[model samples]
Target: MSKPRKPKGRPVSGWLILDKPVDFGSTEAVSKIKWLFNAQKAGHAGTLDPLASGMLPIALGDATKTVPYVMDGRKIYEFTVTWGEERSTDDLEGEVTQSSDARPTEEAIRALLPSYTGVISQVPPQFSAIKIAGERAYDLARDGETVEIPSREVEIFRLTLLKCEADRAWFEVECGKGTYVRSLARDFGRELGCYGHISELRRSFVAPFAEDTMVPLAELAALEKIEDRDERLAALDAFLIDTGEALSGLPHIAITEDQAHRLRMGNPILLRGRNAPVSEADAFATAGGKLVAIGEIGEGEFRPRRVFT
Candidate 1:
């Protein structure tokens, strides 16, 4: 009997900011995108809870190299805190562990905003991905084991009370890496004398990407449904941002094609005049309008740290 050959989609590269929908996990989103693109490699910068939805930067092939940069950048979130109920997971996913009739007045909520802004201590939810010992904290929590999550200092650049009604309060938070919106909602309810849990959460922006740049999964699925394979591939490719877009925060220098070839060969090339880095630091080097490598510049030489090719 003849065995069938496995299909390999294609070797693709670039970044796709997915407008992740509710009920979709980050890994599931990545898998779907990988299958759609038939990409050899794929990854996401930040982890978003299945209950939350919005900007999720998915990297393909070489673009995966820039995941760390995107993950560390500031994130903006819009969420609603539903008062009178506190959940074990700090969100609607868990059982209500506490409740109260008290609700904070708009004036009081506004006054408390400053305290959450700037650097503050935060304890991540026990039913979270955070590792405790060698196992996931969420695993221990689900097994009914005691979990004490350590508090850490996280930066909240801006925390604003957008709107507040009787049972739900809307907020927008611009925070640095490691800040949890669910935790913020939980803390706000506690501070206001009414227990609460996150009812709705959506990420509007992450680092270099804005809400407008994100494409919903439904749109991508529609594009994939196109009958013509070439047309479908071309349409899908149109949404990918250049790999260099991910390196927007880094300084760049132009190098000769020969230098680029050398860099690809794992060799360092000397820099001169304006092509030199401002100081002894790591920066991006381009050749013929294409990204060559992210290299270290020192003593008039560019040593390739991570070559693109």
Candidate 2:
């Protein structure tokens, strides 16, 4: 009998904007895509809670290095808050802790939204992934331990009341990093004199990606039904977004081939005149339209902070 070929994973690189479905954790979604692409390395820009569904950008290979940039980008979410009950975890997954009969009117909800806009202080939910002394806050919360998560400053660029019903309200928010939608719901209820928790949460976009680029897991699963393995691999590869695209928000500087080589070797390059940015300003250095490195300009020198090889 002929010997069978080994199923070695491929060395893939790029970002995969996954439309993470409800009930799927961010880690599990990364693992699924990593297995599908047979990528050598993989990570994600940010975490999408299990109860929330939408854009979860997965980075393969070198793309993982640019995760910080993407994670720092603003996020947009559409969430629904069902009033009358507050949960221990701040979402439907937790135990109901309090109840109220109050429901805010559409006019009332709209009035409160302006307050949420601009810079605001938000206390993260106790049942969160935030690490406290090497242990997850959620883990400690589950064990009946009181986890005091301090309030932090987060920017909310915009907040809109989409709908208001007798027992529930829907809202859309555009906010900076570390802003939790669940906390918004809990606080919103308190502001309106009604206890509430998130019933539905969906992230519409995560920085550099939109609905057009999101690939549903169902679509990926369908590719496996293809009889030809080579054709299937080609189809899967088509979904990859170039790693350089993740740095689109940053300023770009085109460098010479020699400069690219030196940057890749962990060396600095000199820039003069308009090419040199203000001191300490980070920018993407590219060569022939391909990313060479992400570096900060200081004293006319582009020092490589993260080099892409």
> Whole-model Cα lDDT per candidate?
0.90, 0.90
**Candidates in order: C-alpha RMSD to true structure:** 2.9, 3.7
Model 1 lDDT per residue over 112-194, tens place: 99999899999998888888898898999999987888999999999988888999999999999999888998998898899
TM-score of each: 0.94, 0.94
Which segments of candidate 2 are over 4 A away from where they belong?
1-8
**Candidate 2 lDDT by residue in tens digits, 171-277:** 89999999989999999988889889999999888888877899999999899888888898789999999999998898888899999999999999998776467
Residue 48: error of model 2 in Å?
Answer: 0.8
Model 2 has an lDDT value of 0.90
